[model samples]
Target chain A: MQFHTLFSKAVPLLWYGSHVDKCEKLTRAPGGTRLCEASSIVVYKSSLLQILRLVACEVWDHLLHFVTLLTHRIIPCLDVKAGRVVKGVNFLGLRDAGDPVEIARQYDEAGADELVFLDITASHEKRDIVYDMVRKVAEQCFMPFTVGGGIRTIDDVTALVQAGAEKVSINTAAVVTPEIVRQTAQRFGRCATVVNIDPKRVPRDGFEERRAEREKQGLFAPHAVIPDGQPDDIVFEIHVHGGRTPTGIDAIAWAQYIVELGAGEIVLTSMDADGVKTGYDLVITGGVSSAIDVPVVASGGCGSPEHIRQVLTETDADAALAASIFHYGEYSIQETKQYLHEHGVPVRLTH
Target chain B: MIGIIDYGMGNLRSVQKAFESLGSQATILTTPDMIDAQVSHLVLPGVGAFGDGMTHLRDRGWIDPINDFYKSGKPMLGICLGMQLLMDSSEEDAPSRDQPIPGLGMVKGTVMLFAGDAYGPGKLKVPHMGWNSLNIQQDVSLFADAPENPHVYFVHGYYCSPADSNVIIATTDYGSPFCSSLKQDNLWATQFHPEKSQRVGLKMLENFAAC
Candidate 1:
């Protein structure tokens, strides 16, 4: 947390106004880290006032280095696509954000609890995970990092783990082959294994009940009805392939099964509220968190610090994952943490 | 040079890099014979099941040498599973058909897993992953420059309960206050990962290097 010491003596430009002799007044700022004061020589020119304003900005910039704070955590997710970070609206219309390694470094410096690198890049060829990208980030940063997106076999897990990934997330493979989660937990230990569940909220109000009656009358098909016939509070349904394909599996049930199989953590993303920047799906997040004993990271929609605070405080989820707010630089990890700290939520202050 | 013992575990490289970040020379000593005259301080860095870790140590002939290194009276530090391996025995391997896996017995303690039932329903998460503040039970030089109530990163299931309370250097509360760090003579171990704990962690490591 080094602040660049400035020793500037700029020559004043004199043209028309009368001025007295140069008078410099030195004053100390808060925390006594540095002397940030102004020399008022009673210059009449407005442009000279501009120099004073610039100096004030510089002083304020150094103020960020003075404060040391701590508490919970604010994690920013970097969905990597083709070596570049990207964000999509509801897992579609992918747009480029920044470089993965560069964004990772920024988050590390900003004091994120953990960084999750989702290798969203897909290709025709069966290539290994972005190992080189993970390796570079691991070498440069010293925070807990989790790598996910298309980790299938034990060899894939081994490669990523050896490349400095603290945890490997399983999503589609956990559904296609449930035993892989147990196998990975057996090899890398449960703490290093995670399951990312992307679920879409099912519409309530007996819609499925009506659809089931229609299907029974041969109006559509046997599998056309929703799983529970639209129960009043049927939470959410699991969706795979970037939340496009719906599996009749209940999101809460799947979370419990995955935990039973040895997933130490669960990352639940709400497809309904994702990319909308409203807030996390607290109902599902809290439901799944309370249902399982492991730490649940709430993912999907987090627009502001208040949104994060709400999920963390209102729900029993251990952590909250934000993408849009952090990606567009609306608020930094430090600012979000400050909001949480002021709101009486315990979070790590000094990075 | 700090010898980071690599008994076929994860994050061993991370520990080495952390030491290097502080301008300290740390080398990953793989074999038992490698930890000889050149090694200044010995560090055991590990992550995984206790039974599997001890098995790797025993099969690779690291058990006797690690004991010999501890006997050498040189400063030694163990992190996570490395800390658990310092106990006399561990219940983590009790379910196995073979006899219970024994530890190095450097400290009179047994490693036990945190039972999910004891903490009541949904009270505590297993693995206790993430940062936890250290309630320093006994003050030492390790946290000299670190902030008060230093929060270090941890990710593990089992914790060591030493028979002798005097050896406990610090404790962290997940559902209950458990021994998070302890020091006995030349041996010091922590259940947390100082390498990943950011600034305060870096300071603690720097203090260990100075010690």
Candidate 2:
């Protein structure tokens, strides 16, 4: 089957770090019966050293899968805050990297197939896109580039495209006015518009302890995170403004809706995996990729070439986008591609 | 000198830059007076829907001037939505549902939607997004040294199906073989965006510039 057809049935996987232990202990199987099947463990130890070990393990697993098929993309995302390339240190605070142009050049030379420049500060100001940054990056960058942040109207998209940006990504504005996607796609072309979905796993009802703990502590409890409110109900909720607001809509349903609304591609960024430098939340990537027919670009927690290999193998993503690892010069594009090739994954070689 | 007709569509800057990238001078002309004064190659680029775009051109009384410029027989090119407006009519109109809005009529075709097994049954995904290979149907100066089956960027849902298939110089597959480009004498139009399309797209623009 063609890749697009397979993508239609792709299932998104949401990573709940070790919540299985809590579920098994908290709720006794009815009459102490073996109610639930043996738990599937998906754990990510956030320690720097442990992450490195996990990276090695994941690479080995990916290498086995790569021998069978050739697909997957390594994408680098540049988060722009206040007109500078900024990455959230552990998804907490932002650090500036001076000019976007210089940083984009580095990524381009480093071998990023596609680049996403997200204006992280646009929603706060409620302004249109700053074309100057777009123009600067577009001037030097030679790869397919997607620019998000502060895209409010057709004019904003037109300005970005005119300034040399290939695709205009919309998130907040898309939520506020869903028709904006269709309108922009109608005017600019569907391929020119990309819908960026930042989703977070929310506690389902019936999972009361997890809800209570989350409410009181003002933090996510990893163990009780999967909402058990609805039986056999695994719901992924869509969040806007960098996972700051819950839209009360199912992430899978939203992904299908945006695609119907003429979105050329879907950029799925796992809020849980973002900036963690552990790995992509395979569960979410798989779930969303399976739901939408358009190409899915997996975003968030990509730390190594092994991480890139695992994402393409485990998830249905057409491409995997990372920031910190590539930006910090931990790996070069040629090195990653060569690694993928050696591992049996099909990747475009630089001529 | 390439004359870029600027009728409020948003792609003038990028198109001009593409021409400049190829070492060609492109002048964006918005007024009929300017187009009349400058008798050179003409490029009509647009970014919005067909009906509104035509309305703006008519509102500014550009139809007559544009027709006059076309009669001059200098090379003329239309990009993306501009290419769509070159048709005799389009099905994309809402307010003027039954009305047949006039296009440049340089090519004898009407804008229509993609049909058959490619798009499947349901809501059509307009604005066929992303990079797709262009199947060059004929030898034309517009392509110049560009590679065959070169991937060009596309962003529109509706495409121009010329009444005369012989005019279609290039075609691309997106659910179906839609006319990606058309050329008649000195008149040329591309459904794909050359400015946004990287090397190959620029090459096409450079061909236009050199022509």
Name the best candidate (by TM-score): 1
lDDT of 1 by residue, A213-320 (tens): 545765422222223224555547777889987665667777888999999999999998898989998778877887898889999889899998888765668888
Interface RMSD of 1: 7.0
Candidate 1 stretches greater than 4 Å from native: A1-71, A87-97, A124-129, A203-235, B96-100
- DockQ top scorer: 1
Per-residue CA lDDT of candidate 2, range B1-211, in tens? 8888888765466677667767887787878788754547888887666777888788878888777767777888888888988888887664454765667665787887554224332212344544556778898888888875676666676789899988989887555477889987778899877776666677788788777
TM for every model, in the order presented, reads 0.80, 0.70
Candidate 2 lDDT over A27-133, as tens digits, reads: 43334333234455222222334444545544443333322122355677777877766653122122335667776656555556667888877454533435777
| Most lDDT-accurate candidate | 1
Q: Against the true two-chain complex, what DockQ does each candidate achieve?
A: 0.24, 0.14
Docking class of 1: acceptable
- B22, model 2: CA deviation in Å? 2.6
Fnat of candidates, each listed? 0.40, 0.14
